[model samples]
Target: MVTLGVDGLVSGLDTTSIITNLMSVEAQPQTLLKSQLSATQAKATAYRTVNTRFDAIRSAAEALTSTSLAAARSASSTNSTVTASATSSAVDGSSVSFRVEQLATAKQVTSLEKWSSPTARADEQPKPVWPIKVLDSTGATVGSIVIPANATLTDAVSAINASGYGVHATIVQLAANQFRLQVSSDGTGTDGARTLQGADETADDPQSQTVGTAESGFQRSRDAVNAQISIDGTGYVRESSTNTFADLMTGVSVTVSKADPTATSPTTISVGVDGSAIAAKVKALVDAANGALGVIKGYTVSTAGSAVATLQGDRALVQLGDSVMDAVSSAIGGKSLSTLGLQLNKDGTLSFDSGKFTATLASDPTTVNRLLSGVPATTTDGVTTAAVPGFADKIAALAKAASNSSTGTLVQLANGRDTLANAIQDKIDGWDIRLANRKDTLTKQFTALETALSTIKNQASWLSSQINQLYNPNKSS
Candidate 1:
């Protein structure tokens, strides 16, 4: 019934220290569990790092398989007066010569009699007659504009713009008090020409009213004209409504900047393959593969005086590195990475030679394209047979298999490590609880022992005092 932890009070012994020492011996298994947990966590971290490198390589491989690489072309113009652009459909190494004769013109008209006051109040000005009819090139009515009775030249211009007949109207100031309403076609071409008719039908004498001519209100400035160009020679000429001629050449758009029909020389437009761009894409793939190789080597290789890497001797990581190297060394269409100027090093990494690759691309471009992008083969009966996959295709598949979240090798390994670490932590926690209970029980036992020892000592001291008194009976009363 003694209170707990009251140790060595009467017996003069360090019972608490003795109990702590015993518990420390019992905690050995818990310390081992903690060490195992730390190792498992480290392994998981290493796997995640490798997975990141795999993702980068996968992205690069995907880019190498794009269709744009096969259709890359560049076009250049010799003369500044002409510019051209080529698309994927353009034929490589093709050239064309052409001279721009004339540029398309838009129809523009200005007011013959300038309005005296441009900034005059709209309420005090006499507006032009309402319902100005708009006409096209064929003298057919297209639309009409109606202005308010007391509107200024600016107001009338705004009304004309809102008519929605493919005509734009603006008020141009000539002098301090001189202003005119200018109207022009919204497009360039003979078909885009516009004419305005403001004949006063409401007047009793309709013949006296005029509209489009200078006597009425507006005067013609420039008439719409078509564009003209001569191809190869002056005997063959082409005409268009706009300067941009897309039909003149297949997959090539020619934009004329100036008109010089009489010029002796014509602008030469040349379309050809863009070798530098294709080489850059190949370099990216090589770099990504090297990056993945470096990550794998960092974990697998060992150094003196340093702790072994977490992934050292790990079979999964070792196999992954081997697979990547094998893909590079394997042949596609009897052509390996060496043919493309990519060399496999002794350390399982890739080295790229830009100069050699560029030369190979220029000399045998078709073969290079076929090797990187595997060609499809068919049997004699026209039935599809086994198709050869490119090196990039093989690497992409390997990356996906190794990094997949659900069933990938690295992902599974990381998940297993996490599970084992959690289990070990649980065991460590259990040991903590058991040790605390043991310490409490030991403290209670020691407290009881101390109480009993104190009682026995008191009893012995009392008995000795009684015996002394008995022996000295008459010495002191």
Candidate 2:
């Protein structure tokens, strides 16, 4: 069908402008639906943002309520030569004094004879048997290496290194065309010494001389010794294979870097509660809570001439904020959050007073701990009363409830909004089809009207012409 326009040829009417005006009026409802859909999408995005904040707050709360918080300990050593570290299992407020008598040493050995050159031509050098035997501190033949005939000194060094006897071998060049093979124990201890000998010719003792060329004879270079330390005066002495002493004390490890047997002073190792660290963790919890509250406030605020708040008049967000505030204000161990330096502000968020918190920690740290993490309540009667939940516990529970995917408030609200928006979009689509059909019908009707008017005008003009011809026929002759 032809589309009617402003210049109707025979009807002399502005049909195009009229149809456009009517279509504009018909599209009002669809425009409103689209606006509502945009607002719903924005609201869903806002809810997701708030949900992320809630997750952060939840994690912070979990950290505050963990057992590690209460068991935290820090260790310090008075002497720089001594390094100490403690775990959560370490006893708090425990101190020990110890004197370093000796540090553990590793055993090393070097070839008794020096070679002319390490990288000399292998075929020119006198090679030992097919393989050489390596022995441990116990004089047992532990491993063997193959020194192929006519191989260089570097090859011998590589073979000795490949022998799995807990020893490392290297070629030490002394001067031009002069090198010595040195082997050392991989571990520091009296039991870590190693020896090398000819294959199938080892004596019963490690110190026994072996039959080989002067260049292949191994001699002791360094002696291995165990570490010795005296703790709490000379009454208690501890011995270790390595410089690091772990079993001397529970949950504490001390590494001895140097020996000072003649020194009159002993290194003091102090183990105590890490109050500042614990306080900082509590402050983190407060900060996270405030951040969550700030997000809620930002998305719910309604300012004049400003963009509409996505979560404006959202009861779920309002209730969530209120719940968090309630948790903060809740009493733990009969003490309010203000007592712990977490003060509530007028804008429904928390502010941490570092000075006050530090003072509280300095004065009575146990009280602060008990307040943040409550103890088991004493029962007065046989009907046992439940333990009081701490601020962190309450906050964690609230956040968990709000962020639960299956039944969370934000999730449910977002789902509901999505459903409504989809339904509205379906309605808008239907209206699109209906409006197109209506416009097509109108265009067809106007086209038909124009065709009828054109036919009538042509008939009227023909009749007038015929009547003139009939009346003026005699004049024409």
Candidate 3:
């Protein structure tokens, strides 16, 4: 029969194994929670990075707004030179003139190559001529024309205009019946190729004309105004085109050319912040941020295909997502993005009412600028104030808010998470400590039980031997 000690030994071993396994099951949640918290922190960091880029681009755009450049034109008659004066609000408002010895000019052609052959419909009578394509110095097709055999210059102009390939045909009457064909460009940029084909009724068959580019009046030369500048009462000599004048003045681009031999004309082309472009850039950034925010706000578990396993309904995630929206909405300037004419759409995109925005800017540029720079926390004198009132202040606040260090939300989340993690860690630590102790205790109990069992068994053996010897009679002595 089994002894009590043996039965106890079997029970202790089974209990130890079961308890250890139960402890592991209880610790599972803490491990998973730590990972979730880490993911939340990562998402926050990504949002902050995108937010920072938006702020940077917006600031750059704003600074460029309202800046303007002015230029003065002058030309020298004696030297065929041109000069211009460039100035800006920030630069010294003083005018400086320089001598331009030469004006930028390009070669122009009085006539484009005529197409010896004309394309005719099948129903039309056969015309034994081919159309020619005209090219400029760069071998680009500037125009094309068709001519009947031995056609006069008068006939050529009429034919070119009728072709409708964009080149204008004009005949200059210099001498009696001495007509020169003039072909002008239809658009900007360098001229293109002029080619001839088919037969000229009176001459040899028309071969392709050698492509030639006429010189343009525009030249690459120094600005006559700054050709010589008295910098601190000293003169600086310059050559070439007025683009050099651009280098002298901040934000001024001058086209230098000869107005006449006696005067060098420098025209200062105004270069200012394209308000439209700046506004567009601002709208794009806001739109992008809104897209991301909208997606997060409307996140649905239905998209995940398993309602029971969805993270969309998680309270922690929802709270975190709301915080992200609040941060952005609160950071933007004025009453809201909507107040600035940026409206959100259902598909998570933003559209700017350009007409409304333009009207606001035109009516009060400064007010618009200030609105763009700040958040609307309150209203005063019929104007909404920003949550962060000034451009400089807004930038500083955003920087502070986005910091991942001790004072930032990231740090707070991390610390809070660490607190939760530490709690779980503490539990795990306690479990480890308990496990060690339990394991040690079980080892001792098992060892003690085994020793007792051995002793009992030995005692039983001795008792049985004595019983048998006594029962055998002669064997007992």
Best by TM-score: 2
Each prediction's TM-score versus the true structure = 0.63, 0.72, 0.43
Per-residue accuracy of model 3 over 1-477 as CA lDDT, tens digit each: 122233345234554454457655754665565566555554445444434443443443334232310121122112233333333431433234444344433222453223222321211222224465644434455555666675655566677678766445565555643444455544322322222222332222226554332222112221112222222223554443222445544544344444332333432233332346546655654554454445444442344454332234545434544443444345343356555566556554456787777676657655656555543378889998546554323433443453435565434544664566556556656666665665566556665676777788889999999898779867635
Q: Give the alpha carbon lDDT tens digit for every residue of 372-465 in model 1.
A: 6666666867777787777777888889888888988888888899999899999999999997888778777788788799899999999998
Runs of candidate 2 with Cα error greater than 4 angstroms are 1-26, 104-171, 181-220, 223-228, 233-243, 303-305, 329-334, 346-348, 380-386, 428-477
lDDT of 2 by residue, 108-127 (tens): 87765677888664334333
The model with the greater TM-score, 1 or 2, is 2
For candidate 1, the lDDT comes to 0.78
Error of 2 at 176 (Å): 3.5
Alpha carbon lDDT at 134, candidate 3: 48
Give the residue spans of candidate 3 off by over 4 A.
Answer: 1-246, 253-268, 291-341, 347-349, 352-371, 374-411, 473-477
RMSD of 2: 6.0
